[model samples]
Target: MHRSLCLAALLSLAASSALASGFPVTVRSCDRDVTFEAAPKRAVSQDINLTEMMLALDLTGQMAGYSGISGWYKMDDELKARLGDLPELAPQQPTKEVLLGADADFLFAGWNYGMKVGGEVTPDTLEPFGIKVYALTESCIHIMKKDKSSMEDMYTDIVNLGRIFGVEEKALALVDGYKAEIAKAIAAVPADAPVPKVFVYDSGEDKPFTAGRYAMPTALIEAAGGKNIMDDVETSWTTVGWEGVIERNPDVVVIVDYGDVTAEQKADFMRKNPAFKDIPAVKNNRFVVLPYAQATPGPRNVEAVKTLAGAFHPTVN
Candidate 1:
């Protein structure tokens, strides 16, 4: 019996050793192969979504510093408290110099959020510094393939981050929790209920920018028992004329809350516009507000779906 116990202990130790040495994780990002030698000790995250992702994973201790629109609006109290002490590298998007100066081994940022067009910093540019940059799965499509962005993309990202950090179990648990929450939100909707026609108001008045099929908001709308009127748009976010919006006449208007303009301001603009006054959502005042961070692919997506579902199907008490 003692021998058997020793054998079992040896096996457990071997398994733990294998997990620790399971490094050199490689993931495809923006059509390029990114390989990590080991779990990053110091990581600099960009954008509120990515930063929150690190916090949600209980990896805040791995963070060196963060620079993004974290303060754009209010985040959940727990997330805010978790991030309250992290050093700020920048308030908004940081330049390549600023990012490099953070002395981080990894950078978690999506397309256009950290690496911009004609910018000084990029995956290729940072490779020489021994830094590995992982692009958020949702934005990677813009630079590579044509896969329509979905919640699966977000899940895949979480899994990848988990692998890179050597925290596969934690990542899997987070994904499972999110999946259950999303399933619950989906189950709340009755099969016989008709899907509401929904229009997403992101920004722009004359052009009326809205989320396309490639954006996460499209998926959130669908899960919420509503169909995006602009789901036909192949791009992530696009501009549509007022005539186009008036033509569809969405039953609910989901305002993307971000930038200088508040959600209330955006709704007020729509209500006051003579051309928009006759629209169903405008006339009925059926406006649902979602934070810009939630609209993006991130941890708050489950909350975003729940919020929109409540608005789309109010009867589902």
Candidate 2:
């Protein structure tokens, strides 16, 4: 009995040591390096995308509070169940005071969305408080002169957060699962199907706001076997004249479904407008509606790809 007890104690110690081996994770963001000495016991999510990511990793228990644009799109039921009444730090971006009061050691947010450059609650401001901020990889280029965005950015952010929270295995599995789902979706597209020219309509009736080359929507379009007509623009989101849309005359238009305006209203507006009437998509009603959440850089990107693929190629089983 003495020998058995000693062996059990040794096995327990070995398990604890193995778990401790994952700590001291270091990841770079923009131009700065953020290191996690150990899993953060308290964290704040500044964006709904980040909130969903935390839920995906089963780290909701570590979340102290969350803030950002809510009600843009309804979260999945599973996510809603997991989220369950977490305190709201702010309706939009939390002020420095709110952040401080939360006493969180970690913050997950986008560039401009969370802590804007030279803003009140920057990484510099938070650093003095012993807090580490991880900027969304897609927004890094716009804020930090980093490389252009890619789907990999989202995957890397997810994995990095996983490492910080000591959920490396879960994060890797999530990445692999998303990759497989995307591959399966893309493979369903017919090889010989004509790629549709897609126009992303993000609102703004007067000037017309749309996604550009650096946006995640562009990457989703490419993955869906479609071409973003505005991919020529060298920025993320930009305004273009209706003349540009008329010039391209894309085969399909993707209406971003978000706050206030409904997808049907956007379609109707296009149908009634004389300038867009001549467009092939407007004429044939080839408009695809994508939720605002899925269109952004996050876990839903693969779902966005699958959605676009189905709309682009109806022949795909």
Candidate 3:
């Protein structure tokens, strides 16, 4: 009986160690402990960017619910079909009752802005109800009070998600492919050649919203071998006067293409604006329309870089 008791005690110790090994590590944005109960069999993604990452990681089978549909970055038809059975959580700011009632084991979201700034659901708010939350690193910067964001940080986010979902090997493979493509594109550009000045016109038709220094679009412009004309602007989003755009005369105008607005419509809108008609890009028809997903800093950003590189240097082949 003594020997049996000793064996049982040893077994219990080993079990505790194993459980400790499986406990989720605290991430950058939130204060709460994010340990998963059992790898989240039923998960709900609060943001479309998070949903996209799950799809990329091939963890869509575990997805129990999602927010945002039929927008610029709509899920694939097959994925959309699966979502019909899942609960509909609002993309912008889902209520606590709505989130809790979904009965999800885990909640995945891109940023804390919706929960933190809006006074909606939070890490502490969800923990009591038995839900674990994971915030993507791309959106963490918004909550962090950091002055600068980086491309390396974006790559780290992909690898981190891959680690969480047990798809590190696949994530590395994807990263390898992306690196190869970017290197090839970069090699073709001449070092002495001048980088074209670019203006990223993201959404907001009323004020002509433009990408400032801190925004993801500016990072993408630099990565794609172009110069952001408004890199001097410190804020993320700024309303520039039409006279300013005409004076800058950027070589390439990148319009954030939404599902509701077509590329031609955007071009026409710019052409009609009296202050923009004389700009070289508008006059010469050098307009590149970037989708909403590509413009944002997330897993798809590398693809956005590729698109921009192709647009800027068409002769690269």
Q: Please, what are the lDDT tens digits per residue for candidate 1 over residues 14-49?
A: 777765678667877767777877789889988888
Q: What's the best-to-worst order under lDDT?
A: 2, 1, 3
TM-score of each: 0.90, 0.90, 0.82
Better of 1 and 3 by TM-score: 1
Worst 10 residues of 3 by lDDT: 23-32
- Per-residue lDDT of model 2, residues 93-205, tens digit only: 88888888988888888776577778888788989999888888777756655445467878988998888888889999999999999999998888999999999998988
In the predicted model 2, the residue pairs found to clash are none
User: What are the RMSDs of all candidates, in order?
Assistant: 5.3, 4.7, 3.5
Model 1 scores a TM of 0.90
Candidate 2, residue 208: the lDDT equals 84
Per-residue alpha-carbon lDDT of candidate 3 for residues 1-317, written as tens digits (9 for 90 to 100): 69999999998997787566553433333333354434576677765556666767777677777775443454556657645566556645566787767777677764542456446576667778887677655455545544444565556656665655556678788777767776776777667656889988875566678887767788788877898888887655568876677778899999986656676788888878777777888887899988766776566777788888888888764
State the displacement of the C-alpha of residue 2, model 1, in Å, after optimal TM-score superposition: 35
Question: Which candidate tops lDDT?
Answer: 2
| Candidate 2: C-alpha lDDT | 0.83
